[model samples]
Target: MITQRQILGTGAAVLAATLTVAGCSDSGEQSGGDAGGSASIVVSTFPFGVEEFTQAVLDPFTEATGIEVEIDTGSNADRLSQLSLADGSNGVDVMLISDTYAGMGEEEGLFQPVTAADVPTMDEIAPFAVSEQYSGPAYSYQLNGTMYNTDELTAEEAASWDLYANADYAGRLALPDISVTAGQLMVSGVAASVGSGPYDVDAAFATLGEWAPNILQFYSSTTEMTNLLTQGEIVAGDALNGFATELVAAGEPIAWTAPAQGRYMATNRAMIPVGAENVEGATKFIDFLLGVEAQQASAEIVGDLPVNLGIEFPQEIIDVVGDIAQDPTGAGYETLDPREIVPNRDVWVERFAREVVGG
Candidate 1:
């Protein structure tokens, strides 16, 4: 029953500051420079509009490693801008980036290269967690799928992405706009289901055209979509796993299922900026995050599927989201390679507006 306003911190602007284990200080040293010399690392994360993530993962890492963790959080665009401005001299020690930025970050030399040897917990993770599309490894995962009110749409009708394009569901649906990853995923999911790859841009555009009439509104955030769902405004449509989990837990009548064609899977990778002062400490912390304890906490607290295979999720999570812990590819979930999608992001956005929204 945790509300979005409760999980997502108050919208007050959080200044980026390096907090030491002892207390908060504003010296702004990239690395820990306190007289005590206790190691500290600066980490920048994309605020998923949630506060529980900090308590579930970041705080525990600091307590266990005795490394002061400096936190900076913002929207995806804001975080990337802050990272691009940093040159490692005053850069973040760890950066949690989405697949959209992973390739660009590597091309810009924003992160240090890591391997299984560098991170012992690497082998315990799913093969996809190593991230073929990005230089950094994935720490958490999500799947894009159709979620709907079971009272209205039977599970059979909601069982596939095809439901979005169904003429019967027109004017009662909600969809993600191009700004969010879920919107991009909607493109890929449609393309694959209709027999097209990332290269076939027209195929995706055409599919969305068919779906446009059914979409009542295009949502820019999970909070907006959840509001629509709670108000009985949106009966069925595509959405991310975590958002759906929140709605279900809050006693909403909504339910989710990956389509038969497959869900579009994504991951958030954590990278150490090239100029990180505490490479060893940062690596250990990354390794710790991939361990069972942190992974379990994330799953239980935020419904973020852990990349680690060793950890078991609670039955409640399983009931709401079946087989989410499995390798997305192995489970027949089609993943849009970030490498392929990143280059064409702008074009896709433009087409989404012109073809889907404006059509």
Candidate 2:
């Protein structure tokens, strides 16, 4: 379900999951070294095909810096294990992981600390997107909102987040379980609508309890939520921009919209291993990614929001995400600091189970 606990890079469950990340062989030799002595570095990103990411971010980076690049793809758990094993010389150079894992890795001295001086293009990122806990700023994000089956409800009825609580939606709604990122965003957005921020755990809980009756199911993933919508088993619920775009591409009659209170945002960041053999090259790659060209290209390929400032999205994207820029930290949207949610997440998840799900 990708909880903050998992994202924070902790828990016995995390240990168990990472222990399963066993495929990559440990290499003593430097990766991707060319005849000119320019050394290559290995990078791990979300579970993407080597060809897809190679075209999106890696190829442009290598072309610009003359540094060779090797790519690894896996879940957050696997990436954390790879980072732990790579420290001090085994050779994975950089990784794109959730903010929680990055912070935990920095604390354990597994990753190098980054600053604007190290990647001057950090100036192009929103202040909030720049990590206080890791070397790389946020490279991309998922802006979340209500996704509804267009044939089932008018756009006006789905214009506010309060629809999750309306009894009128009984047997027709779906939502993320409290343990996941989308669930946390739903809780925070509801809390904000009631004038309570995420810190007021009681307020968020109360809001969920009120909405519990109408929630057809508390989903564990976007796939489950979208599948229900596709089959007409559910009408609407919380979903991310990227995945919803996939639903539309697959021919489902679905649409995503930011409600009156605003949408919730979460970002995934990139980090360099603490003792990278090619620190200069790694930093250059990070800077190149933060630049508009890479950022825009990524948005086009992945459908996730870019973190680079001043990158205007296409009219089609702007239509789906009205009032909110593709960037979460951009003007007019409400953003949640994973830091604020991490400390209280376990308690909130427990409470949500007992109170709303009747666990």
Candidate 3:
């Protein structure tokens, strides 16, 4: 089909055609774009942590059909804006975004609500990603509780997310910036050490206070943390499991602990955008992504677990990618509640901005 520059000015025309073809609720069912008689479909998504998989899974799609595939990837937030701006009324045919981001969009009435019927792999996702309103458990990951230099950690230290700090360990630690669920849980680990424990905000802040004088800089972004770990700029702190894996995989001196404390998990997804007409193609693509083979390929390429249990990866990926890991207490997504940890996301977001990040 058409290239980026060709479609750039056609967003409005595409959206208008979609509106003419179908009707959708703001938070209701969405349609795909005009697959038309064209030889290919253009797909969009936010850039993944690793860029290798951008087109890895698409060739099969092309071979199966004569449809050539075009990929546009960017930050999750930015991708949302682009899709919203393009709509189905615009030329953006399909979108692949994180579930958490989808939840936000779902709230904005951007995506159509969906069920397992829409995408079969919906059943494969861990409960952490599912919600009553939106569709899917597309990609799943756990925010693993890890220690740097696993070689330097003791059996006791390896066992829990409790006070990982010691007088000497102070000032050398790098903690996750408290912005999302992972950051909230990182604070929870410190709470457990200070008697506040997991899901207790009061305790988390107290723990931070204790370490404030000694703790290294509280990271504000994912990239900063990754770079710091890579250059050995900092040794250890509460880190995202994926980043921890990247560091270790790259042979960074850091080692990660699969802590017994409950880890935070995020399941990402994609949904049909409102005010678009590609419903036929968009729905098919969503269904295709949830299939066993596609899920498996996605997990292997991205280093995140497939929500589908049957999708198996090589041993190397399963070992690194975060799946469902129960806490030492054994109460996780199955038995425990998400609200107990985050409660009101708005409140958490606000608190994180002020107290945690000092923003």
Residue pairs clashing in model 2 are 114-135
The 10-residue segment of model 3 with minimum total lDDT is 19-28
Error of 2 at 307 (Å): 1.7
Poorly placed runs, candidate 1 (over 4 Å): 1-27, 30-38, 48-50
- Return the TM-score for each candidate structure: 0.88, 0.82, 0.74
Give per-residue CA lDDT, model 2, range 1-359, as digits (tens).
00111112334443344323322332225443332243566666665433455677778887877666665555666667656765634455667887756655665678777678988888988776875645668887777678998998877788687788788779789988877677777777777777556456577677777777888899987788988888899889887776777666666788887666745777788787866667776778788888988888776765657778767775556656755764444544655665676566677889989987883
RMSD values, in order shown: 4.7, 5.5, 7.4
- By lDDT, highest first, what's the ranking? 1, 2, 3
State how far residue 264 of model 3 sits from its true place (Å). Answer: 1.5
Worst 10 residues of 1 by lDDT: 1-10
What is the lDDT of every predicted structure here? 0.72, 0.69, 0.54
Scored by lDDT, model 3 comes in at: 0.54
Expressed as tens digits, the lDDT of each residue in 16-64 for candidate 3 is: 3321211122112222334334344456654443234534456555555
Across residues 90-130, which tens digit of lDDT does each residue of candidate 1 receive?
44667787877776676677777877797888888888788
Instruction: Assess candidate 2 and give its TM-score to the true structure.
Output: 0.82
